[model samples]
Target chain A: MIELEGLTKRYGEKTAVDHLTFTVRPGIVTGFLGPNGAGKSTTMRMILGLDRPTAGDVRIDGRHYDELKDPLTSIGALLEAKGAHPGRSARNHLLCLAQSNGIPDRRVREVLDTVGLTAVARKKAKGFSLGMGQRLGIAAALLGDPRILLFDEPVNGLDPEGILWVRTLMKSLAAEGRTVFVSSHLMSEMALTADHLVVIGQGRLLADTSMADFIARNSRSYVRIRSPQRERLLDVLHQAGITAVESGDGTLEVDGDKAEHIGELAARHQLVLHELSPQQASLEEAFMQLTAESVEYHAHSGTPVSPQQWGDDWKKG
Target chain B: MATVQVVRSEWTKIRSVASTVWTLSLAVVVTIALGMLISALARSEFDRMSTQDRITFDPTFISFAGMSLGQLAMIVFGVLVVSNEYSTGMIRTSLAAVPQRGTFLFAKLAVATVLGLVVSMATSFAAFFLGQAMLGEHRASLGDDGVLRAVIGGGLYMTLIAVFSMGVATMLRSPMLSLGILVPFFFLISSILGYVDATKDVVRFLPDHAGSRIMQVVPPVGDDTPYGPWGGLGIMVLWVLAALVGGYVLLKRRDA
Candidate 1:
């Protein structure tokens, strides 16, 4: 288990993480969700004692990270894909980390097989493709067989097969009663993989709720209706004390389970119905709405900023 | 984190990379080969030397002349060993594994320093013997009064050079920036300063300048150096200690 209490980090005048307090419990995969620059990486670094927090503290397994006899055995992390030395072979890379934490040498080869990197275990990381590099990182994370695992954007540049493999690995690890905390900006991926969600925006906690609860609270479900005799339908709904929202294009959206009532009312009024269907908002829309204000870069059509321009803008802010 | 585990881990890290083998080999080959070549030239030119020049000529010191160029390779080895972690972003992973900053830094230094000592000692002895062979009748024997001391000091000098580079590299945290400063300062600036009458006093205190004194079996005639061999080495040790403390302080405070 990992617990953070009032954790904060400030880089000069700008705050990267603010008063974050949460617990990552074992036995489930917790998805950390935020837009770019939301401080997810900073928070994870603090948990691992990589970055010193400006305020408060974090404890791993009820002790400070440094106090643990062997930290990797308690919590394993894959912060980035290319964190390994490019000149070192995959097997040797894992071997070094394993030796540091007193993990046996056999664990290195086991992790290699687990991640399906045994074929290239002797190859230098410099020659590995993006997906292969990610696999090596994952293999490193599993080297100590830590109970708590933190992965930052683990699926960033992976193919469909690799993504699926990561998703299954996360699930299986969680099922083994381990604490699996993974960060990603991709909502669709989280929706399929995570059992719980801890979301942030502008370095502040936006939501910390179960997956079902978040979806149920954020996703909007409504009844849609369109009619050629719009005036008659409006009169019938007003007489029946039903409020209908006129969403342009000669259509109306009514909240709640009013589709059947509206249909019966329209039939009795003899109004011609062009379209009447229930509309449900997707998780993607809900995520966008929650993070709209915190989005740092606005994508303006026809005036697309080059990659270098985007980097410059980020530096300016 | 146990110091022993971290040391073992650092050993693996140093040995697994290609740079370690390449850099150390280059240091050995360059130092010995160049020393032999210089020794051969010095033997041939002995006849043309003035009486004063011949009187001041130290055979033991002459053989180790190649250290001026060879130490640059040692600097590269030291800089790469420390700065590669930062450049490749492995420092984050490394620190996370061993969160005790002091243990991580010191363990790495301990492993690298040990390797540097072993390789440098072998190189020093090999260079001395081969260069002596080239010098023929002018060669100083190991049985000579101060010859063994000078040879052992040559190994110590090379080891200190590499360790000093490691300390500076730790403080800088970038291989290119560390090399940019260390290479020019040791190779050109120190030597240039030593030749100028105005800068002679200050140049003697530089790490390389003071440390290289150990290889001198006989002082130059009429020379008045401030410190003796051990005292000069002491000055170099002080410089190395200061750099290491600065590096540790910075590493302890900075975010990985």
Candidate 2:
């Protein structure tokens, strides 16, 4: 178990991580979600004692990171893919790390095979692609088979198959009763993998809840109804004391899971229903809603200005 | 964790990279080869020298002249050993494996310094013998007074140079920045300062100048240096200690 209590880090006047207190428990994948420039990376660094926390404590198995004997055996981390020296062979890279923690040499080969890099074990890391580099990093993290594992942006450069493989790997690792904490900006990816979520925005905690609960609380689930006798259906819904808002596409959207009630009411009134479906907001929309106020770098969505506008602005300047 | 494990791990790290082999090879080859070339030139030109030049000619010191240039390679080796961790983003992983910063830094330095000592000793011995062979009748043997000490000191000098470079590299944490400052400071600035009468006193305190004094078996004409060979080496050791301590303090205080 990894416990962070009042973990904080600041750079001059800028607070990179602010009072981040969350416990990553065993036997579950805890997704660390945030917008760009959030404190996910900084928080991970502090957990490993790579960055000195401004005012707080992080403990692995109830001991400070530095106090843990052979800390790799307690908590393994893949902070970045380019953690290996480009000139060193993959085998040697893992070998050195293993030796540092008193892990045997055979484990290096085992991790290499586990990551599917055994064929290129002797090759230097400079030749490896982004996906291969990520694999090597994961191999290093798994070298000691620690109870807690941390991966930052693990699937950033992976292909579809590689992404699936990483998802499976993370899930299996957690299933072995290990604490798996992964950080990513990809909400869709987290929805598929993460069992629990600890979300932050602009260095502040926004939500800490289970995957299902988070989406349910932050988003709206509504039932959409379409009928041939739209006027009659509207009257029936109103008479039944249910509010229905007309959608832009000529369908009525009721702000609750009233699909069954609405269907029975329409049938009782001899209303011919064309479509009746309930829509639960996806995790993506929930994340956007939760973080919309705190996103640091916002990209405005619109068409580009025409050349004439650019010319006119230039002339005015 | 035991310090021995970290030491062994650091050994693996140093030997696994091609830079270690290439840099040390360059140091040895350049030192020995250039020493021979200069020794050969000195032998042929002995007849044309003035009386004082011939009187003060120290064959032991002459053979080790190649270190003036060869030590640059040693510097590169030392700098890369420490700074490559930072440059390649490996320091985070390394520190994660062994979270004790002092143990990690010192173990790495110890391993690199031992390797530097071995290569420097081999190069020192080879340069002396081959340089002496080229000098022919002007050769200085191990049996000669102060000759063995000077030869051994030559090895110590090169090793100290590499160690000093490692200390500086640890402080800088960037190979390019470390090399950019170290190479020119040792090669040009120190030399220029030593050449100018106004700055000669300051230059003697510099790490390279004080350390290289160990190679001198006989003083130059009109020699008035305040420190003996051992004293000069002591000064250099102090410089190395200062650099290492500064590096350690900074590394402890800063984020990885």
**Predicted model with the maximum TM-score:** 1
Model 1, docking class: medium
Task: Itemize residue pairs with steric clashes in candidate 1.
Answer: none
The recovered share of true contacts, given per candidate in order, is: 0.86, 0.89
- The CAPRI quality class of candidate 2 comes to medium
Candidate 2 DockQ, CA atoms: 0.76
Error of 2 at A117 (Å): 1.4
Give fnat (model 2).
Answer: 0.89
Give the top-scoring candidate (DockQ). 2
Question: Which portions of model 1 miss their true places by more than 4 Å?
Answer: A248-250, A293-317
lDDT string, candidate 2, A209-278, tens digits? 9988876686688999888899988998999999999989899999988899988998899999889999
DockQ of each: 0.74, 0.76
